[model samples]
Target: MARWESGAVEPDMATQAAMATIFHVPAERLSALLWPNWLPMGELFHVEGVWSPENCHSLLDASGDLMLERRGFVTLAAGSAAVLVREWQSVGRAVPEFLSGTSEDIALGFEGRLPWLRDLEDAHGGGRVRRFVDLELQYANELLRQTGHGGAGGRRLFRVVADLCRIAGWASADTGHLAAAERYFVLGLRAARAGGDRLSGANLLKCMTLLLAEAGRPQDALLLARSAVDATADGPPRVRAMLTVRQARVHAILGERDACERLLGQAETAMAETDGQPCPDWALYFDDAEYAAQVAACHLALGNYAVSDHLLERTTRLQPASRQRDGVTYGLWWAENAFRLGEPERAAAHLSETVPLIESGFSTRNRTRFAQVRRLLHPHRTLPQVRDLDARAASLLAWGA
Candidate 1:
């Protein structure tokens, strides 16, 4: 508090919200009190926690969104987490209901466009689309308070919020803002739980698992993946299949080949059960190509280079070019496996193709993978092809920096 007053520090979004709860005031009120110039004192005191209709409309103005740097977790105390959970539960009810459209209409409008937004993220990378998505989410959240459907309407709105949060979290992680992504994922799960949408909650957990695993915390990834499977045990078949695939990846990381294969088989069985059923919109993209990519990843981790290379070949061909991030990732994996197979020329060729996509997408996730590829090729830098690859890799890093 002293540091904050001294202008040497400021609370993060989570901290500010927590403080608001403790002070029995709204977060914006706390902000206004702390920084007198932020909002007119008379209006701030009158508005308190809830925004007036005019204020809500004005908040929708598309000013630039803030970008926060990533940080590791400082574990929440049990009591604090519980309080946080309660605060999240009240979010929908607390929102000021001043939107032009009816709640259902607003939700449907957002839902209808979400697929397009998701596709844009997949094609161009998170840095390009995150701000737009954030603005849309803020608008959707405000609409929740004004929805007209009673209990049913509230649940539907909450479901949409959950999905939007999940997408935003994915984009954050892809752009390397892991701390912000963690906050978004937690909020998404909270929204899902509030709405009694176990499937969406579990899906968010699976995404968190993927982020953790990719960031080199396999144990944390495994725990979250297991939680997802258990939470959705009796939920949608496709979602169960997706979570099980995540389990297999963690098993592979643990070097348990038999365990990995067992879970993979289970994942396949779960997927088969969904053959004639309509899967959740989020799980629809976890198709054969995605399955193959998971399998390739497991084998690659286990040092089964030949098998990984074969599976990656199929994955690369089957995966659409528009999903530039995934394409570049798969290409990097293929190149790594080729290098492990004593084929530097093949590796160099794959790296050459991947570099362009990585540059175009500007993904930190793919850039990190490329860094590993560069390190793997360093031993052979004397070769002309390796040297050329190294030069391109350096240029890519410089441009990103």
Candidate 2:
């Protein structure tokens, strides 16, 4: 057991089967799965137990530890993920009951700081803000344990904690802690459900959808993405547009061009309907520029380099300077598209513009993208422009090291 835990060796099939039996997992499952993947690791397996305050508290406790201790991306079986989505869909939207208290003030105070924390993350990246967000989530969890859940005050507190969990989950993913991200997202979904915050729950589902897509489970991702859209069908136009765009992204990944295009059109129409109307604070960031950038991602996946480049150009121009991480990401995408179009010089130029931003930013995800772009440009290294970009990227990689 110690050897297995320390990565020194693998358990043989017989031992794995025995262990599965000991853990109450079906022994027959061992033939198709390896150790750990077969283990019911988180609250997801027990999603149907109940949404009581006690269960939410237990989930918070487990997920807080998950964020701190778990490592690597644990791929849940596709069927398990589908089960989770189905349970989320069937869960009642009623707020849970709780002991009345004044935690509302505390929760409100935390809420007041969310926008600033989000801005800080946008400017600097997840590595810079992950610990801070984790600490906030911990504190919120502690508060929840103390205050109980489901009154008006408790609902507000749960919603605030859910938002924190959302940010924490994103930060975890940004820093390459995907297992932790998945757990935190599930925790946030539970909290949102407890609070009856359907919009917040939908947002968490959307985040999970993207995470799964990035993890190479587009089928599961598509299921969750559709669930997110269905959950928020009556939400504000901007929010609906944001979720619809995400669904379009999944369709693009699955090579369903017609479905992708249809969803994109719907997203655009919904965005147009916003017309300056009020939107939830969480949905405010999905403006025209962000929309274009996301659309560019869809086209990028569909192999429309020229169209993606055009949309990304507009995204770069319209993106706020304060959104440094996004600027770097969009710049890298633009570079990739340019290179694919047989314009190495243009690609290198755009890549060069992102060097400084990459230097100042702290996102592992962006850094990975930068490395991929570098590899894409490697064949053209004989070109003077590409050579220069290569040297610059090398310097950034060395600095990161």
- TM-score for all models, in order of appearance: 0.75, 0.86
Give the count of colliding residue pairs in each prediction.
0, 1
> Per-residue lDDT tens digits of candidate 1, residues 102-142?
54454667777878887887787575677777777677656
Cα-based lDDT at residue 31, candidate 2: 62
Candidate 1: Cα lDDT at 18: 68
Q: Give per-residue CA lDDT, model 2, range 72-169, as digits (tens).
A: 46345448677778777777544222223464365777778889888877777565577787778778778877877756767787887788888888
Worst 10 residues of 2 by lDDT: 92-101
- Give the poorly placed runs of model 2, Cα more than 4 Å off: 1-33, 37-48, 93-106, 397-401
TM-score (C-alpha) between model 1 and the true structure: 0.75
Which pairs clash (backbone N, Cα, C closer than 3 Å) in model 1?
A: none
Residue 78 in model 1: lDDT: 20
Best-performing candidate as measured by lDDT: 2
* C-alpha local distance difference test of each model: 0.68, 0.79
Task: Give the local distance difference test score of model 2.
Answer: 0.79
